[model samples]
Each structure stands twice: as C-alpha cells, then as structure tokens.
Target: MATHLITGAGSGIGAIVAERLAERGDELWLLARSAKRAAELRERFPAAHTLVGDLADPGKLSWAFGHQSLPVELDSLVHVAGVVELGPVGETPVKVWQETLAVNVVAPAELTRLLLPQLRLARGHVVFVNSGAGLTAHAEWGSYAASKFGVRALADALRAEEHAAGVRVTSVYPGRTATPMQRKVHQQEGVAYDPERWIAPESVATAILTAIDLPRDAEITEITVRPGR
Candidate 1:
C-alpha cells in the first residue's frame, strides 16, 4: 500500500480525503491541530498515525515530523490546512493576513521542503488544496485570495522544479464548498447556510484521488472544480 501524509485531516475536505485514502487501504499519516479531533480520527482509523500540532508554527511542525518514525519514502503528500479571514484590505487585521499566509502558503512550502528527500525517493505526488479565490480576487477576499495565489505560485514552481526529479505537483482549486468554514463565511456575510449552493467536500476528495491514481507518465497539473449553478 502507498504511504500518504495529509494535513488538516481533522475536518472538512482533509477529513474526507483521509477517509477516502483509508478506504483504499493506504497507510496514512494525519496532521491535525485539534487533539480531540485527532484522537477521534485515531479511533475511527486505527491504522493512521495522527500528529497533533498547529501548522502555523514551524517549530511545532518540525518537532512533530521529526518525532515520527515514518518511512524514508512517501507516495503522496496532500496539503489541505487553511484559514480564511475576509475583509477589505484597509480593514483587515495585519495579524489575520499573517496567519492566513503562514498556514496556507508557508507551512505547506516548509513541509514540502522537509519531505523532499522522501518524495524524491518514491517519485511522489504533491497536491495543494487551493481555492477558486486563487484565480480571482473578490472585494472582501483580498487576504484569502493573496494566500491562495501564493499557493498557485508554489505549486507551479514546484512542478517545474521537480519534473526532472519525477515528483508530480498538482494544485486543485475548488470553489465554495459545503464545509464548516463555509458556514462561518455565510454567517459573516449574513447569508443562510445552504449546502446545496456549495460543492461537496467529497467531490473534491474524489478529484484528488483521481490525480493520485493517474499513471506516472501523465500528470494532472491543475484542476478547478466549480459549483454547478
């Protein structure tokens, strides 16, 4: 079975992706911020290795990965952890911008750097769970859009740099999804939460799985999933 590491596996798209991988009998390493949620995942998927720590903290992330006795080879790494703080550029808090970039861009970049050796050994695939905001910036989504744009840049650069190394990089830009974070966004916008109006997290997970399942000769460099209006 292929070994995969997934970030933000405690909930939302990450959790659904983790479940799909587990169903395929892949060995999984799950990184989650919540200890309670990590414990629950451990119970549900007893074979998974759950790491609890904040992705924004480089030191904590390093410590967690360093302590784990993972194999020298990894088949896949899926980055799904992110934070959204919506506001006009003038009104947005500096701290929110910092946190958003840290989690959405910096953390994934650092983790990928750390795992490069392992990935190269396996000629692994790296998937970045980006967003539609990465493509277009909305009025109140400057900070989030900026971070996602960084994600797109990172994936593009990585794909180009690692092509010779046989490491595939894909960025999946999913539109607004039915997730807890979406609910919060809806609340912030004073709109009712209608799941039907959003894309399902599982659908995104399926797209990711398709990328992972592709032959080594072919690479799905980027995928954009939009809600069917």
Candidate 2:
C-alpha cells in the first residue's frame, strides 16, 4: 500500500480524507499537535501512525520532528491544517497575522522542506488544501487570504522545481465547505451556520483523493471545488 503523511487529520475535511485513505488500506502518518492529540488520533484511526508537532509554532517543528520517527519515504504529503482570525486590516493585530501565517503557510513550507528527501525518494506528491480566499480576499479575510495565497505560490514553485525529480504538487481550493473552520468563520462574521448550505467536507475530500489517485502519466496542478447548491 502507498504511504501518505497528512496534517489536520483530526476533523472536518481532513478527518474524512484520513478515513478514506485508511479504508483503502494505505499506510498513513497523521500529524498531531501534541502527545494528547496524537493519542486521540490513534484512537480515531487505530491502524494509523501519529507524529506530534505543533503547527502554531513553525520555528520549533524541525526540533520537534528530530525527536520523533518520520516515515522513511512518503508517497504523498498532504497539508490540511490551518488557523484563521478575521478582522478588518486596520483592526487586525500582529499576533493574529503572525499565528495565521505560521500555521497556514510557514509550517507547511517547513514540513515540505524537511520531508523533501523522503518525497524525492518516492517520487511522491504534495497536496495543499488551500481556500478560495487564496484567490480573492474579502473584507475580513486579509491574514488568512494572504497565507493561502502564499501557500498557492509555494505549491506552484515546488511543482516547477520538482518536475524533473518526478514529484507532483497540487493545490485544492475549496469554497465554503461545511467544516468546523467554516462554522468558526460564520461565528466570526456574526452569522448563523447552516451546515446544509455549504459544500460538504466529503466533497472536498473526494477532490483531494482524485488528485492523489490520478495516474502518474499526468498531474492535476490545481483544482477548485465549489458548492453544488
């Protein structure tokens, strides 16, 4: 079975993706923020492996991973974890911007750098679960949008650089999925959340699966998923 490493696998789209991969009998390495979270994930996916490292502090990830055992080679590395804080640019604080970028962009970039050797060894794929905000920023989406845009740029550059090495990179930008993150966004906007109104997290998970499961002869560089409703 192919081996995959994934972050943000604790809930929503990430959880669904992890479940699907497990069902397919693929080897999974799930990244958790701490020992407690890792234990929780192991309980969630009994057969999967767990790695503990906090995405909130990207600077310490390398140090953290040095103390853990990583997969020797990964068929795919999927980044799905992210944090968001909403406020007008004039009202947004530096800490919010710093934390948002740290988790959403910097940590993913750092993880990719640290795992490049393993990814290269497997001629693997890297998938970034980006957001529609990465393409267009709204009134209170400044920091989160900036981070997603940075991640999109990172994916593009990595794809170009890794082409000769047989590594594939894809960015899946999903619009308003029915995830906990979406619910939180609605709360931040002071709006009621109706899970039925948005795209289901499973749909987004399917899109992610499609990218990674495609035949190696061709690659899906980027895909955008919108609500059917």
Best by lDDT: 2
Q: Which numbered prediction scores highest in TM-score against the true structure?
A: 2
Q: After superposition, how far is residue 58 of candidate 1 from its true place, in Å?
A: 2.5
Model 1 residue 109 distance off true place after TM-score fit, in angstroms = 0.5
lDDT of 2 by residue, 1-229 (tens): 9999999999999999999999999999999999999999999999999999999998999999999899999999999999989999999999999999999999999999999999999999999999999989998899999999999999999999999999999999999999899899999999999999999999999999999999999999999998889
**Tens digit of lDDT per residue, candidate 1, span 24-118?**
89999887676787888799779998777677775567777676666579999999989898889999998999899999998999889988999
Q: Where is the poorest 10-residue window by lDDT in model 1? A: 63-72
Q: Which RMSD values do the candidates have, in order? A: 1.3, 0.6
